[model samples]
Target: MASNIIHFEKDIEFSKKVVLNTSKKFPDPKFIFSETSWKLDQFQNLKTKLNFVKHKLNDFILEEWHEHTSKMNPSGLVVNHVRKHIHPDFLTQAWCKFYEIMCNSSLVSQKSLLTGNMCSVHLCEAPGAFISALNHFMALNHQSIKFDWLAMTLNPYHESNGHPDTVSDDRLIFSTIDKWEFGPDYTGDIFQPRYHEHLYETISKKFDNGASLVTADGSIDCSDDPGEQENIVMSLHNYEMMVALNIIQNGGSFVLKMFTIFECNTICRIYLLCCLFQSVEIQKPATSKSGNSEVYVVCKGYMGRSLATPYIQMFFKSKNHDNALLPLSQIPNNFIDELYNCSSYFCDLQIKTIEKNIITWNNKNESYKEINEIQRIICQEYVNRYKLKPIRWDQDVISSSNWSRARNNKRKINISYSEKLRRRDLCLQEEAVLLYQEIVNFSNSKTNECHEILWGRCDQVSLNISNVKYCLGKPVIQVRSSKFCNDSLLQYRIKIINKFPCIDSLSNSESRILYFKTKLNYSKNGINICDLTDTYAKNRNNNVILQYSCLFNILETLQQKSEDFLLIGYPLYTQIAVACFFVIASMFDTFAIIKPDRNFGHAFAFFGFKNLENWLNILSEVLKYILPRNDSYTRSKLALVSWLPIQQLVKQRSHLDIVLLNNLCIAYEVEPILLSFIQS
Candidate 1:
């Protein structure tokens, strides 16, 4: 009985905390007594006390809440179990997850900081993207943002920031609100309580410190008032034409829910924000349950003249609410990387940075790749000298041309070896096609197979490899920095990433292992595959030794290849997200920069980790410093790391040059030796 009483007291206390955070203390006591407010306190003093109680409520819920849940709804676990299936739009899903975790009280306490310093407003409006965020928050953690007079409120969701795209504007709930007599329902302005207290007080004050909403004529352009650069202010939705015309100092953010009404004015407002803000990205919150019209937010940085940040002289409220950016300039250059290198953009300080530096990109400049004959020669010499043999699982590599000829030769009745050779030669001249449809099916079929036909001028063949299914969706994007690919191997890697978000940040090491293990499992017979990194490193310093000992007597493969890489005709920077790296002819022989053991060491690391593991990490750092804010170098770095597959390298174990050889030896467990001379 005593425990029960204590539990009751705890519940009451938690209720108070929720009340305080969700609502604001109205300065006008008269407004609180109005019919709009009841049961909940107009001022949140009691609610503040309750939140302290609820801090402990978290522990209590974890320990005892489940018991209450089990009793309240027996078979509760199975009854509500369902998978949330989201299709495509991986970036939108990412943005939603960031908000869901950040905004929820259960997941993150108010006192702690969040990643990316991203911020959001529960736009006082209803049924829009803001509400969608709220619903997502509730669905993810089961904590609804219980509101003011929720039960008694009529047409409460009229101005919400969500709406199904298919629904015509005529059927909108607001359609009726604007035209008909809706009884004091529309009178509940979120800013009403504060308006009675202070007019000059910034919107931040009336923010309910939760989410605030405003309804303005959509005809006017929205902007923060530049005159009042005192404190940071943001509008979740921008039907308010005066938002941008009346903004606070740095670190202000605004999400404008707009139609394509004022194209010129909209462009001007956005352009100004881009100039003042650091990093800016246009996003559509696809995860929003409301699926409302497009939301374009213009976020700005805090504007306190700071020597630390001379660029904007911006100052943001620190975690402690003090003038935090005063010493921001004192931050070391090295530490600067950490601050800028984050995922979130809608937050406080970080948002300001992103807003100011936002770049509008129309095209990506492909990395310059001039054929280096010296590097090619060096790579060849290194490989030849190391003598590392590629895994010989297949009888021969299906060169770009031979795939069709082999198929045609098989079709001819008992064709002679010479005739087969002729067909194989002809296959090289044929146009590339996914011919598998003639003998196979495409999407929606039960199996994973490649079935298109690329009929060439000369040859025809079927790529009926069994491991195709596993290869079908390897990379959500292509791996290497290549232009185009017709190879089945290339196609598989490209499709894989395009399908799976989990593989987005995978490193070369991880992707390689995944490919090999998957292929090995699906292969007709289980084969003992060789470790590429180890093999290459083992014979790195001695190319000839590796080739002669580990490989069959296939002579002059490298020596005969053109010294000028320009002649080889390989594409540049093959889709880095897809696998398509080819050694050009121009690179000097024995010019391997990364050793196998170290560069492709684990074959199971994420892209981030792989870059950091190899010397490539240093190179990436350089690119980060050099590339513009919107450049695809970061993506390139990621793709480069994902391109190296464990099996691909292990199967093609080749020798490394001196630089790579030394690194490989050290990586593959070589001991350092000191040379000392003793005079006799």
Candidate 2:
């Protein structure tokens, strides 16, 4: 026991000596690529020379390290335990990290910055775990802060962004779309110089005094090139720092995610941060998986934007493609030595963990009892220390995106007549005028060469081949959501199918039947009109863009000169719905919006003799209006679609058709109408 104690003390002393040597050798830091070719070669040489040393394991046994951390880290274990019980949005590893930061650091609690208004900007923040955690933290600690936040991330639903590049899960974005800035192109890609400037302007406008807290958790999926992870993300890191520095207030705090900071860019970024902030510390939170080289650089007491300008101009702004920020010869020797020592220390720690995991993996008799005990004790301590309370996820609190779950519960709330009127009224005439102007502009604009011929038509369209009949053109091409499977929607479907027999089977080679049986998820009690309208208003552009993309894809497949489209359960007030009407009107001879279910939106049918030649010629030109552009926010096509007058759409109108559309619109209360309050 005495010998063991002595060894532990010796280990502590050795760690201290390593730190002391690093500090003594390099009192100030420098910018150099300490982790690339030079470091890899050095690591290989040391491994070969010290082959007998058990701690110097072959390669970094990352998988084993993951296993080790999962078993050992109490916070990680607690996260897994509570993940399912709590809302998915609030129970992420990232959530725990923010909570831990709040508990440990003065990022949020700094009294000087906690004035009347507190603002935070979350960059590359998707699935909004950080925001949720911060909300939870504020509720528990400082309820009077009047916190306002804005988040940006790669638009998950963006047609351009694919997997490994964007966060595809869009629950958070869908719920709180208004709070997010998708940049000019609606693709929140900060790596682009344009987005950076746009975001800077947006932050400046929103927060005059600058953000009190700015957190950037931006990272590229470098799984394919793990060895050069730091190098791969150097540009992104620089951009994140630039944005944070430019927008952060004098005493604001910035929390940035970094990994194995050995690259020249990484070193330069860190050195700059150290210079710009009063205190900067590297944190490897317990919530973060130990296998990966993930660390958060917590910077507090920013020395203001003026101090950051020189570094920004010298290193960040300059587009010199050199590997090092400055030549190694020019950098101070002490700084280089410090960088090397720090890098080596982290590398050693990683190697030792890997070696320990390897030993554990080999030893079949290794007991995890100690680990289990530690997890329990630490988890309790963590909860107590952080003062974490179970979050009550209410509608007004954290608007969860689990609409399906809400629908299942059948929860209803009483809303006032005025509120109902507000939710239901969509000014069509106003929207149409704007839409018409946009259409005119689009028609005049030059067509994109790429969309000239939509290459994939058959593959893109969901052709229904199972039930075929020669009646109109082909089998009904049915598009549906899982939400429509309920009995209520099923009845509506039956009524529609019975009324329009040709909808199931189309025999005329010149005609086609497109049926959309969509029933979007609503709350358990029923549709929350307020929630629905608010969401629609926020995502109007995106919805238009999405609809346009889909319509463009389908239009390519419309080989038939005349195509009939049936859109069910769509509120005609939406721009996408209006766009559908416009496209059908442009191609077909007749169009009608009919009521299917009063509870749901409306149904639309467009059928007539048509020729695709003219439509095909103008397809790209017409579609350009819906495409997300630099001027989407200012000259929004959605605004036009939302308030476009329904009357001006048709050249010839029948009383019966008007009554049908009016009834349909009134049934859903989706179109502009004044409600007269009569005594019940």
> 426-542, model 2: which lDDT tens digit per residue?
454443343334333432332221121111121222212222111111101121111112222222322233332211111221121112122221113211111122222233334
lDDT of 1 by residue, 240-336 (tens): 3233223222343334433221112232233333444443334332122111123334232322212112221111111221222113222233322
Prediction 2 TM-score vs. true: 0.58
The number of the candidate with the highest lDDT is 2
Residue 155 in model 2: shift from native, Å?
Answer: 0.9
Candidate 1 versus the native: TM-score? Answer: 0.20
Clashes of each: 128, 24
Candidate of highest TM-score: 2
Q: What local distance difference test score does each model get?
A: 0.24, 0.51
Query: Which portions of model 1 miss their true places by more than 4 Å?
Result: 1-124, 135-241, 244-252, 285-295, 298-680
Cα deviation at 657, candidate 2, in Å, is: 28
